[model samples]
Target: MKDLTYRLPQRRELTTALPGPKSRELSARREAAVTAAVSPGLPGWVVDADGGVLLDADGNSFIDFASGIAVTSVGASNAKVAEAVAEAASHFTHTSFMVSPYESYVAVAEKLNEITPGDHAKKSVLLNSGAEAVENAVKIARSYTGKNAVLVFDNSYHGRTNLTMAMTAKNKPYKTGFGPLASEVYRAPMSYPLRDGLSGAEAAARSIRAIEQQVGAENLACLVIEPIQGEGGFIEPAAGFLPALSQWCTENNVVFVADEIQAGLCRTGSWFACDQEGVVPDLVTTAKGIAGGMPLSAVTGRSEIMDAPVVGGLGGTYGGNPVACAAAIAAISEMEEHDLAARALEIEAIIREVFEPLNGQDTVAEIRGRGAMVALELVDAEGHPNAALTAKVAAECKAQGILLLTCGMDGNVIRLLPPLVISEELLRDGLNVLVKSINANS
Candidate 1:
């Protein structure tokens, strides 16, 4: 293994208020120039980031637990990723893969094909974002099965695009005012064990019944799901839920697509969350952690399904940018060399060690998730969503110089997506602050 070092000190430091004077000035400028729709989580005005620390313009250092929405699994300023990006940029940046092919793009596809589940013959198509990868996965499924209906789950968050918005379950911020979404998308019951109190098989049966009664199997093109949901409270389905769905998709000829955009690439103690249950899908959509902060995504699947799309029917001008591909290659190497998957397991153990006892608290409904992607579901004494307390806890953490993120349909789940390369001391400090904040808010 190669020796790696963090560029900045791993401690959280506060020299000014939450949104310091510099951040406040930037926020004012942003309000005037940028639209109100583009709201940032914390007005920190980051100037540099390394390891688990984010240095803002106001000279405050924050412990990063969000990982930039799970995009920088290898750390924000990973040396190998930076070196590769600079090297690739010096050579040539853009020569659209469609117009003039590049070796790095093909190399990335090959790497993805080899790492993704299943030993069968497979292929991959690179894209610019997770939404595009999912959209293309659906397109490939439709082309292969000649069906138009897509099946998603309740409480699922796919993307913000027209088709994905139609597939998503949340209606408030993502779907509101963006009506007239794409047609032929259906939602089914998900295996939420905490809320439903049903076994894995029982939940699968319920979903199967819904599919059969509402949208018949013959009419469905694909069944898309996030193995460990990111925005939907990091919900991990019951143990046997995924396997049963995979079998059903096989029997009905419907493409099984695992939306591993946020949960894949070592974020969940494995290359992909689907691997935890040995559930191999026909298609897998990947992004976020793929390139260590670079914009890149891909859909890897069985050769026949991926090949179903016509030659010119797929691809974009910046689908497989060379620099992004290089960054992906180096970031993948960093993960492999450093064994970040195992590191993720260590992070999980640290988090659970600190948070497991909170399960008995009246305001804590559940503590669930796998690997580095953990969530704390906040609820009132009557078991109702306590979004108010959740927001307060996050605000308090931010004031203390710890960057936290909240999610869930009701905005009552606090998600922790620390970079896989984060040190144990830094992660524990962040968690300690979070626990104190939760206790204070409660």
Candidate 2:
């Protein structure tokens, strides 16, 4: 394996059409063997990657803007991440964290404790995915608080697992037929300033009132929230909402959990999005971007709450795999050394400078977000959401070689989660492409 500080390569390259012949062949074989419902929307195959460029199997190279749904914070094919993964793979790979403890696993947990918010003594338990961490968090909260119900926000996206699906508020794509989900999950209103006419305090009050009335504070085990709702449209709760909710949780003995899976690891210009509001949650769940693309998730929280679950209740056979833990350690170190949080702020600045002017335009409704975790919602002159326009803009950006993703409950928001390590020049170029796409669509 190479040294951890090695750098990445330059921009994209393309010699053949996207999903070149080789990729097409492989994709066809996959379609034949696997369910077509799980296929990805964009180019489906990647042969190799270096720096920000992904070389597809068909001899096409493309700049990766999605970052694997905000997982690869350092950039795809980061040299340090690659070296770390290679080194870990060369060592003993699997020893279930429960069966035999390993240094990397514990080291990763320690890193999470130090990096996550609050000076309180924190303990971490590793998991394989964000949903697992969230699920375990509920289990711990219930065990500790002796409560039956959990409170989740509307339009929130936790994960695809059954319990998480029940916790998730979306319907068509994620929860369509997953009937009779886990019981005792209650829904609450999320404070979306863009659509909901309320300030942070007002929104928080309204949501808390609903929770208190519907579930009764004593019956609530935990209140789980996404500091910046990922699939719910990159929505940042009203400024005071989080702090207010945290205080309420404290007084009511409800575990305040922040699901920072998509908003952590400096993607939101902060170590965790909860930091934006100066809110310290009892439990913080993180996964995306933690291992620079490796599958690793964790639930870090107050030591006592974490200890609520009895011994044997909190692990998986593959939880805390050594390689993923090693990758997490290296990825987090890289984030710190490179000051990715500051870079996320820089990215946000660039985005605001480019999109702020569009705010008052008939085709643009609102430009909102914190740090690089930014989004813009499209609306018509009458203030109706223009999902069609957003879709057109995204397609145009893709055709012009700039990748983008659309999100939000109405599908009218454009979210940007570029790698924090992307060069300023390339970043600006991509933004320019986005502006052009929006203008053309308008």
Candidate 3:
């Protein structure tokens, strides 16, 4: 297969208005063909992306801060990942692992096993998405413990699947009008230091007490949590909260599951965010950045817990596709060779330099996050969530040829998930645009 010849420039340049004429044309076609339930984050239609640059249909170049929602840590079109994907596709594309296995599948699993939080003997089962990995993790936990209850926290976003919808905290968009959701899923308070004014230990105590009173530990199959809560405003629980919960789970024999779908794969300057806290979970669900934007996910954990489920209990036809596996292998290599984890730390410093000063401002409530996965929480004069302001800033940034993403329970957060390989110059330019927009909107 021949490859595209154009070299993507690592800068932001807009030749036309926000949508451009071609993008508006494509938008019309999408309106007729695509469902209204699905929405595009930006108006521009992406034609190509490399490093931190996105080329849209109208020839407008954008600086990427969304990184496809943290999936492209190695960059949108890393040479190694593209080459591996093309080579693998040339050989063969699909042969369901359940029916006919391939070496790439095992290789991906092996890599996951090695990179996940623990040093203990571990095994992995690949799947199609983060929600699938989470569901399968619950199944494995239940199979091993023979329990019924699953515990999650406030402001958590597991996925949109039936089970995850029940696990998720938000109701309006994700769970509303979809009643009779999966049962036995319970919610507890999460550590929001800014909101609660509590220390890590205090937050953990609050959460543990809620779990005990609401759902007994003995009855819980697993307690799933995000080390650095992603959709929940990038709230990194206070230092001791995770360790405290982990210990409680160990004492109670409840499987501690870390949902690292967004914070893993070196996005947080560590292989897994759990590593930063020295809290090792029994089962970890990873996706998003794992395969460099490929549709792949995995549940990697202790061998005993992973093996509890029957041979055919966990897998999908498209799970661990060969081409995706090849991409993962190459993506992991790029992460290691370039020490992107360290680069994430550098990115965090740059972002913090820009956002930290605005923390106590009228419109900026807080600034929090780790490594390359950072965010700014917007609030009104009375400290209430200012979703309108957040929307305005993101829209203004997009209009200026910089892509940004927003997330939060109240939709008042601007998250930064820049590609790990983004050049310092491009990243600074994007940040400048974001700051200008925020100031302009505020």
User: Which candidate has the top score in TM-score?
Assistant: 1
Q: After superposing candidate 3, which stretches have Cα over 4 Å from the reference? A: 1-6
Candidate 3: residue pairs that collide: none
In the range 69-161, model 1's lDDT, one tens digit per residue, is: 999999999999999999999999999999999999999999999999999899999999999999999999999999999999989988988
Q: Write the per-residue lDDT of candidate 3 for residues 1-442, one digit (tens) a residue.
A: 1112235777789999778999999999999999998889877999999988999999999999999989998888888899999999999999999999999999998998898887999999999999999999999999999999999999999999999999999897999998899999999999999899999999999999999999999899999999998887899899899999999999999999999999999999999999997999999999999888889999999999999998788889999999999999999998998888888998988888876557667888888899999999998888899999999899888888888899999999999999898888888899988887777777
Quote the lDDT for 170 in model 2.
84
Ranking by TM-score: 1, 3, 2
Best by lDDT: 1
The whole-model lDDT of each prediction reads: 0.94, 0.85, 0.91
TM-score of each: 0.99, 0.96, 0.97
What's the best-to-worst order under lDDT?
1, 3, 2
Which scores better on lDDT, 1 or 2?
A: 1
Q: What is the lDDT of residue 246 in candidate 2?
A: 95
